[model samples]
Target: MSTPARKRRGRRAYIAGALAEEQVARYYELRGLQLAHRRWRGSRGEIDLVLRDGDAVVFVEVKSAPTHARAAESLRPAQVRRIMMTAQEFLGREPRGELTEMRLDVALVDGQGVIEIVENALSDF
Candidate 1:
């Protein structure tokens, strides 16, 4: 049950998220990380980006807003937990399995399109 306006807003959010992911992906690519997967999802949750940085795997969560602080604040603790769980699921399915080092990172995109990457944003459980 949805109204046209709500549907439109949802579509706009999806487009914004897609743009943010693309911007963040390019930023990582320029730094030599290969794109392992984009929008990796499991029953646990969805990870915005999964990248291989050398021998380590980087799981990224991208947030976009009018300001960096706003974008950073958009991520909830529950969401992080889900992302971490999804990351575990992703790793278990990988060919390398749990052999590689893994890290969680966050990428914030501002309205002006500036990209900021926060590395190792989460501590391992």
Candidate 2:
């Protein structure tokens, strides 16, 4: 069951997330990376953004919160696993398949719309 307040909150969150993703995508695009996909979903989970830097693939997860640190902390371990699984599924479609060079990044957006990108944030996971 969903209440009106809950629904409103959910809608607000969705809008915020969309805006955050857009900001992150632009950030990468300005860096010369071409946008490959936005909100790309696989059987495992959804990847917020996917970009191509020459021959390498970059998977980005966007998080928004009142502060950059809070946004960064929002990514849970379980989510990391799901993102990894989804990234693998995404790679399966590439011509190089599993051999395709890729990296997972986390983009954090604060309420003030400040952006901070952490490259290879999921490599250890």
Which regions of candidate 2 fall more than 4 Å away from where they truly are?
none
Report clashes for each candidate as comma-separated counts: 0, 0
* Residue range 1-125, candidate 2, lDDT tens digits: 56998999999999999999999999999999999999999999999999999999999999999999999889999999999999999999999998999999999999999999899999877
TM-score for candidate 1, residues paired by index: 0.92
lDDT of 1 by residue, 19-106 (tens): 9999999999999999999998899999999999887899999999999999999988899899988999988987788776899999
C-alpha lDDT of residue 76 in model 1: 89
TM-score of 2: 0.96
Clashes of 2: 0
Per-model TM against the reference: 0.92, 0.96
